[model samples]
Target chain A: MQLNESDLSWRSLPGTLPVRHAVVSREQLLLLCRDVAGRGARLVSLWGEDRRAAGVGYVLVVVLDLTSRLLLTESISRSPNPGFPDLSQLFPSAGRMQRATHDLLGFNFLGADARPWLRHSAWAKDAYPLRHDFVAAAVSAPPLPTEIYPFVRVEGDGAHEIAVGPVHAGTIEPGHFRFSVVGEKVLRLEQQLGYTHKGIEKRFEGLSVQQGSKLAARVSGDSAVAYAWAYAMAVESLTDTQVPARALALRALLLERERLANHLGDLGGIGNDAGLSFGLAQFSRLKEDLLRVNATVWGARYLFDEILPGGVATDLAPTALPILLDSLAAMAAEVAVLQDIYDNHAGLQDRFHGAGVLSAKLARQLGVVGLAARASGQAQDWRAALEIPPYDGFAIGSVLAEGGDVAARVAVRFDEIAESLQVCRGLLTDLPSGEISVAVGKTRADELAVGGIEGWRGPILVGLRVAADGRIARCHPHDPSWLNWPALEHAIIDNIVPDFPLINKSFNLSYSGQDL
Target chain B: MWKILKQIVRTGLVTEPAPNAEPRLLEHALHADIHRLFGRALCIRQVDAGSCNGCELEIHALSNAYYNLEGLGIKFVASPRHADALLVTGPVSKHMADALRRTYEATPEPKLVIAVGDCAACGGVFGEDSYAGLGRIANVIPVDVTVPGCPPTPTALLQGILAALQSPTSRVDKRSASTYQKTEDRG
Candidate 1:
């Protein structure tokens, strides 16, 4: 790996290699990122580090160049004047990410546009929880209640603001969205999250590697497999543990099922929001059925803790074999019918077609990854990019759609669902016979490994550092939501407000995933 | 529009049933199978009491494309009042504790509560870690079924939900349920 002039690179390090290197300089960091990004390197995540183990505070970044499939890392210390080059001017999405890091880790991204991303009154303005001197359960000074956020306004008569939920009318996660709208046409939408900030990252300190995977799984409950697999990949890479072929195949199957299940539900929900009751009812029911079979076959409908450090927990039972095949067959027919309905319904088409348009340029500039990225023609999928197990064996297709609208996103989901179904069938046919998990054995102290898995969302990268005692020094499971969430704002531009749900549902990102 | 309506009718309005309503044939076939084996189909309503949304995801997946829990006639209802079973995900946060209680109270008696995932079963990671809210789902609501994966796979959730709906009166058999909960409990 080529190191930036101000940055250092190390292959095998004293700590985990996944911790990589500290960049040291503040000015050339963005210049470095611009060069790397120009080389087709995908920005994984940028976060602040204020933990005591590092002596001084630092800013961290993880970047992946899809072309070469290598991760580029950088860090700059705060004691040496805690500031870093701002990549936000070049990559606007980097702004929110840098702001989150700044808010949490206390490292200011100089000249970077700072917005409150996941910094929603979890603490007062000066409070930073991840700091080394920070107390976990301290009864400190009573925090002043924050004022109502000054949401951006749209100029018009009768253009009132409606703030909806950290609690919602439905059984969804907590997020407060302030809508500036004239009647049903929304002029501005600002989101307030962190209502469910579980302090997962802060809690990871002093935990054993074995213990951290569980925390990773809960990062975003819906993307449990994705997060868990990413964490495991990081740990396994640090430990240099090779998962069995069958285990790899099974992971792919589970991930695909996850992708299909979420897509089906979202497709249905988006339809429901648009008043396509038939599509909503049918798709939701189909999603339910699919999940039930997933439970029967894999044992859990959502396939959460199934991904262990070394491999999967339990293999498919013999009795579940044909049942799995049968379920897939049945779903294929249902998907075909659903696709037909989605294709022919004029009302559904009208609402979805031009709604929530994220143009190709905006999508790229924002660095949005996952289906939202694919919908806008970014054409990035970690499955195909990073060679990992079964996905490496097969020629993974990166589905691309230029529309970048709700309909385009839905179409991408449908296409991906079809592809995932095919992958499931292939895994079933080529089901390898072997032990599901091999013992992860004692990891060497000071070992670092990087593991990336193409989760249902996109690529989940797990960067792990092991202390000498096998305890975790640092574990970062970067969810795709951090990049995708900001894209939601830009995508909603020019579109009327009533279609927000359709737009939001189309890009159903995880607030909890990113908050942690 | 009427012509389109006629077309939709002709096409049978091709759609899946509500969460847990078995496809027509499976419902018919499983009705006797389930009756002879466990007892009868159970109606389930899922409530999210401030979970990480992972458990609810698995709970939601228990009915989607791959698993199709509807084949067993077990269904997720829109209201707790109309349901016999409660599937709750997440670690009942303080913010959601009141809503969860009201939801549980809203459900009629003979209700079975299936705490899905480590969070719901025992608050998993967020239980003792976060300051945002309360502890386990069982702390706020009575749990009759503990399906414990980090986010139990759809099949695991299905079996646990089906098992809960099946015996209806069975002691929360976490043995079969805990298979997936082997992951570390940061809670």
Candidate 2:
């Protein structure tokens, strides 16, 4: 309420998600963050862009997830090593985001934690890949010598550090986990990610806005539909393109399917981590059945390119309905039985019950979003909260948990699977008949727009700026992992080292999304 | 226990037949040949070389009831030293370039590497030798087989592993490669 329309000139950004953007001064920026924090606004994402090309200077953008809408504040810096008052004191995740912004673009945030994130042996100290003037060829320059990460040491007797990988034992993404442990008891867990940073942000630059959708889908392979939808929404808004109601409904269908697919897979992985191979076996089979159906109905099994810029690439075939409906019913029956098995199983419950307890108090303080946030009693589901477009047509409600433990996260996942299934069925049954897409007219230059869609992980926000010639001037896709990853470090505190995987899976924050 | 057993019984063997082994004569003999010639489990160490986890999804699916990779005497081991083959995914990122090399070196001799997905094959859309290394796993290490897809399906992955197993030598025959020559260790 401190940032009222009367007090601040908030320009509404056109998109599905409720967003109001404004450029403020340095002192006002800090005051605004403090005000929002008091009003229970969760910090969604913070990113910096080099607008020096457009002669606007270095811009640091912070997105705040207010109860019903998103408030974006931009503070500009004129000179080198530009410093802005850090909001990490109010929101803990801001520290890492600030560090990442500094790592990519040379904007500094005045914070206690100034550690370099997403910068490995890939570049030199002075190299800023996201800067407008960064040469593309220089990215392939000779690898720099390794710099030892200054992980905070636990200065106590019997405390030792155990370092896990950027390259782990399994077929999982790369990230380094440093565990400060005493025997099997974990004192603290600090993660240094960026092994997956293949310059996804840098690759986004100079690409025609039309081609950006394909790249966005690959941002995090799992959330392909979400990223694509969010990107498309931004583009559509910027171009003043109004998609047909049917296309919006289809987009919702695809988004829900994407959620169902991820929840199914992650639920299985969670069980697998907790020593339930039976769960992994059964759930994964269910997932495969789902993917195979996707293959038959849609051309791709993973549905990587199913969602395009203007609308969905392919419309639902007549045969897809009965098949999809039957599959959902069968999967629902099997999942319900599996849920019972998991519920009654003594050992599985024992492992999940109290491990990695991220209290509701801490959860809100850290500004965690998505399913992870909901598990800890933060009853903020973006779909239900905003009710944007197709979602507005239906009554979607938040599925919440108060336990803030591994078990709570699992329960939320189980409930979400059922909810997503119901949502998908509703969308399919109430099919809207119309054109699937419309031609997005000429790209408008110098327009800054934001798009947000509730992906399976969380609400993904993309702050897009078009260059003078209609190319992507600066596009920053902020993943929910930005807020949740730091929460993971806190969640593992005082827990045993062996339980880390199960706890980590409960949150399952994206390394690629956060790194990019 | 009875409920669990009932569920297991109801969902009986869902594993499909493995992908194409070779010509008519080699069809039924592929599984038997592994036992007859190698006479051990084909252990694989999967390294995600900066993938979006799309390829990893399929790789993980290989272990599902439908694929049941373990039933075929193939296991995804934790350590590279214990692995007979390395299944790598993604266009190798520069940050992960050294780790990939170290992993390649750590695996004992007579190792087979199968690059999964299009990114690892020719770098896919990211382009070769750009921001993210050579964009192909073969550029960093010796690749015995390559499976192409945005993310090759689990069945395709099973076939790639089997294909790598059937190759006469551990390394790919560079002369046979038509698209691009001079793999780091192409014979």
lDDT of 2 by residue, A1-516 (tens): 255433678988765667888989878888788887887888888888888767888888878888788888888888877888888899888888888887888777764577888887777668788886777767567567668999988978988999999888777899999999999999888899988887777777888888788888888888988888888888987888888888898888888888888888888899989998888888888888989998998887887776666777899888889998999999999999999999999989999999999999999888888998899998887787877888887766568899999999999999999888998889899999988988888777877787888899888888788877878877888788988998899999989988999999999888888776
lDDT of 1 by residue, B88-138 (tens): 877765445555777789876556788877777776776544544455777
Write model 1 residue lDDT over A411-511, tens digit each, in one string.
99899988888888989988989888887877766434566676777667766767778888767667888888878877776788778878999999886
Model 2 stretches astray by more than 4 angstroms = A1-6, A135-137, B21-28, B132-134, B168-187
Q: What is candidate 1's TM-score for chain B alone?
A: 0.68
**Candidate 1 C-alpha error for residue A172, in Å:** 1.5
Q: Candidates' TM-scores?
A: 0.79, 0.95
Report the number of the highest-DockQ candidate: 2
**Best candidate, lDDT-wise?**
2
Evaluate residue A183 in candidate 1 and report its C-alpha lDDT on the 0 to 100 scale.
Answer: 70
Model 1 misses residue B47 by how many Å? 7.2
